[model samples]
Target: MQFFKQIKSILAVSLVLLFMAAPAIAGQPKYVFYFIGDGLGAAQRQFSEFFLQDQLKNPNSQLVMDTFEVAGINTTYCADTLITDSAAAATALASGVKTNKGVIGKDVNGNNVKTLVEEARDHGMKTGLITTTRLTHATPAAFASHNISRNNENEIADDFLNSGVDFFAGGGIRHFIPASMKIENADALGKTIKSKRKDEKDLVKGFEGKGYSTFIGMKGAKAFKSTDFSKQDKVFAAFTYTHMPYEVERMNQYKNVPSIADMTRAGIDVLAQGDKGFFLMIEGGRIDHAAHANDPSGVIWDTIAFDDAIKTAYEFFQNHKDQTLIVVVGDHETGGMGLGMDSMGYKLNMAALNDVHVSVEDTLNDGAGQYKGDKAAYLSYLSKNFGLSNLSDAEAASLNKAMVSADAGETLGYYKLNPAALTAAHILSTRANINWTTTIHTATMIPMSATGAYAGRFGGYKDNTQIAKAMAQTLGFTL
Candidate 1:
């Protein structure tokens, strides 16, 4: 009886151990959503949070990404330079390999590196790519195509057509159409269309032939809304000719174009139809564009749009908690953006953002041109749009000088901040305490946050390549 009792005790211990190890033995996540906020660093996110708090009049408001359980800092250096471009940074995040600047999915010696999206597709998972920039742009292209040069977007478009990715939504339909094709109709925004392709292939038609449900503009996207996604195995949507318009600009001007959240939801709906689950990459690409242009308003609104998309993914993760993994990160820091300026002495007035009615791009294109060489017109424009009042004599002179210089075709080299744009930037910065060090990418560590299955693996400081490695491990992909 004593021996039998001892045997029972041993059996109970064995059962407990097995039960404890069950999670480790279980398969990895079936769904993965990877979001890349291009040029979004810690400073950018903090600024956006502050802007949101002030804009919404809620001090307790937080970004969707800030609510994630696992958070870490990621170093964003390419093999060639400390400061990385979208191409090299994205390739590192996609392929778990370091490549030089301007290269995509290949090493310095030009060896091909398989991306996580390809791995997911190889493992029978559906794949999707959504971006506010062109689908063939560096970030999205790195995930789905390989090219020695990021500029080879024409070839990249062809690669995307053959990539087996289940869904795509963004801009750059020009790359799909042959240069020989005459485009008579305007795009969704009433902009004249022209093909950027060099070959004779109508890739859009080819995509249709391959069973992809293609949508060109706002009209097509609206039509797509009524489609039964369960019957549509593949879907592709493009809203603009090049990159999608900035969120602030889009809100104020192009109401017809789909939002980042809209594309994300559509991609999720289509990709979720697969039984084997899916890998979807959503890029807030224009944040980088705005930062490069040193447009604070544009950057802030686009980041908010990106947060909305994150909320959409978070909502989906709520239901498929056990089967999903969502990771949000940035490729690199752009514009060296900061919340406080020297003039403000650490007092950041985020409320000033609320006074601005339009973007710097809009101010340059629409307002500045109308007020060329006219100081009163420029000052009045500033007062109406950016809430600037009582401009000093020096400030007025500077504005007139800038307008005159811009009118005369004077250019600011490298950083590309023309005199007129610089004046607008200065006003916004002085009002909001926002500061920018440079109009280019910086060698800064970006924030990375994750939740759901295997999220704990991503916590703590990591290299950009490590992110790709961790996701590949979570997906059981041998990168």
Candidate 2:
């Protein structure tokens, strides 16, 4: 008996020593928050911070991402090009693989690549996707579906039915219902629902049949409270017929539309019900759209909204510090945004955007609707919406040219945006000392900031794929 007891004691001590010397398996993250700010480059992020501190004069205000413990930069080139589109960049971020532009959750050869969220679901972790763009848009689609082309949004919406995602909230209602189906209050709410799908399949009913707590439009979303989310396991909330309204537009008029932060909070509440863990991806996708339009103030507003979602995650991290990880990065930079124009010398006056009430998209696309070649009316419209009252001779001349072009239904620049709106946005940007190298994406490296559970691994320079590797490793898996 004494000999047996001695052997047992030796084995116990050896096990304790072995665990002490070995890396911690228990430290693996159970909850992960991945925030991708589409088109958020270094300059864009810095301008946002500067706007809050200097322009808004809220010196105490700080971006929640800035409070992260680890900061890093990552190269964003795709397999075929140095400058990547959102589809390819998102594939790399989601699956740690280089893919051609327009590919989602696939490799260069069109092979389906498993993504972090998919892996999380396979491991019995609940998963969610939230975005300001369509739910089937490139960034969100990469994590939940595989496709050869990002343009096949209807097919992507079909994938959502099989994605096994516990929660999803955003736009893309047009991809769900058939065109023959008409929404009751769509006209009153400014919502359209002509399905983009080739078939007459009703995806909203599919979700309902699958036991998802599905809701449509801002009105349905508003009916739920914080406590309501915790009671449901699977949820699908579509807030708009297309992409969600820009943050500026949403705050000004679309008060019913849920912000990115609202979606994040609801996702956390719902996903936390799973016994194992959860993976949630929140994207401020409108930042890219606003940037594509070269709308500086619009970009800042959406970026701030993105940070607000990050703040929501940070609050969750505070409670689950040991088992949670929050990572914020941009898939790619759009607009080639730069602070301080040559005319401004060393001064940058971002506050010029302060008086602006609505986004360029809202001003030109929704508010203005159509132009009638009335230059005075156009000027009045600009003054009413964008607060451009005292136009210099040069500014007036530029506006006059753009106004005529708009009246002729001409689109300006490579992106083919409305001539008048683009002109006004550009002029306002100049006054704010912001400049753009391109209206589209750039090869600029983006920043990554993280806090909690293996965040230190993200501190050094990395390729975009390596970001996926780090997150996968944190979750005790290989990418």
The residue-by-residue lDDT of candidate 1 on 197-286, one tens digit each, is: 878888899899999999986577567656676677898887667788888867877777788998888888899989889999999999
Clashes of each: 0, 0
lDDT of 2 by residue, 197-222 (tens): 77889999999999998778755657
Q: Return the TM-score for each candidate structure.
A: 0.91, 0.93
Per-prediction CA RMSD (Å): 5.1, 3.4
Off by over 4 Å in 1: 1-25, 182-185, 225-230, 362-381, 386-390, 413-415
* Alpha-carbon runs more than 4 Å astray in model 2: 1-24, 184-189, 225-227, 365-370
Q: Pick the candidate with the highest TM-score.
A: 2
TM-score of 1: 0.91
Candidate 2 vs. truth: CA RMSD?
A: 3.4
